[model samples]
Target: MEEEKRTVRAVERALDVLLCFASRHEWGLTEIAGRVGLHKSTVHRLLATLEDKGFVTRDAATDKYRLGLSVLELSAHLFRSDDPSVVLLPEMEKLRDEISETISLYVRDRSERVRIQAVQSMQAIRRVATVGARLPLSVGASSKVLLAFANDGDRETVLADPSWPAQLDLQTFAKQLDEIVSTGYATSFEEREPGAAAVAAPIFNRSGKLVAALAVSGPSNRLTPDRMHEYAPAIIESAHRMGALLG
Candidate 1:
């Protein structure tokens, strides 16, 4: 039992060391040790093991550590394996063709939302959605849908985060989440980026667990509020279909 506890603790500490990089791109051994509240020798041992696994790299000249390519490689593997976005690519393409706007699939990553896949609009004037791009969970149609369907604890954690809009009223945000849950979709007008507009719907698994959000985004000039409302039904239907395929 003690051995098992030690093993779990070791894993937790290693993960803590890795997560420290989320705040900064690089870290020195002493800095990492202080951040994780571990001794320098223990941190060095953990870094050595992590380096062997290609999860982190140490600079030869500066002795600083940064995330390795293996992290991105693993993220790519995650997108290909059992990810609903990969399975729903055809649907996203069809939606893009139908709406003539950018169709993106977003998944919540802690307090952030990440675009896993995107089908860009063919028009010259359109919002560009890039895969693997991380956006704040505080705004945007996709972020609203992702947060609305999230568990209560996670929802609160994200909203209370220091990165969330300080001036935005929590009560109003709560009402917005409730509205999304009741309506089965969300729409945003220049909430995240000026001149960018989007409408999104939640995608769920066979177990009714919210998995990802399907968003149709474009320039406000083209995807106006009225047009977004018009596209809401199609986006909701496509999201439902995508969820069904997750089984």
Candidate 2:
């Protein structure tokens, strides 16, 4: 994020152009210039530089630009190099031991949330979420926090899905998501699985992008609505520690 504090206007303008591509796939010269509030000439120069570096590509017939293969390659590199579960296992184990509840780490995958890592509680009646288990975006504290903090485009993609709970209308769903963002956490009581209850907090990278959710789950008999609040501070603290390590 230090780069964002830079005095270089050229770098900032170029980055602004790249950000414009996140909301849309293709952009004409005029459209890109208008979005970034730069002159067409300046945008043209920036696009040429970005094109030379393989960060963007221009369509010959349509005279529009899209992200280039190099950008995809960079994204691939980031995924390959940034495996959070490996770095977070120790802290997760510590949290699990302290709380005596199942600790699960989930990341957003399209419109679903997938448990990428988990440490089960010792109790025989504890709730369990296996690694690689995909759960709906509409249910569970883990999934809701992911949806709540996701980028606007990703959030829209999940919201527009037919499976997003019909019981809650779009505006109601939006308000719930906004509440999660405001509170810094979310809770569920058998929303996804019978008798299960959970409290989840968002985990973010240093750049402030949410990367995952850390949740603690157990049987509703033990982790009832009243007791869920007791575990909130612990989960939120663990999320902060893990998120700081991510940076």
TM-score of each: 0.72, 0.66
| Candidate 2 residue spans exceeding 4 A from truth | 1-81
Q: In candidate 2, what are the lDDT values of residues 46-80, reduced to their tens digit?
A: 99999999999999999999999889888665533
The candidate 2 region of ten consecutive residues with least summed lDDT is 73-82
lDDT of 1 by residue, 23-86 (tens): 7889999999999999999999999999999999999999999999889888776755476767
What is the alpha-carbon lDDT for the whole of candidate 2? Answer: 0.88
Candidate 1 at residue 23, lDDT?
Answer: 71
C-alpha lDDT of all candidate models, in order: 0.92, 0.88
As for candidate 2, its clashing pairs are none
lDDT score of residue 232 within candidate 2 = 88
Shift of residue 221 alpha carbon in model 1, Å: 0.7
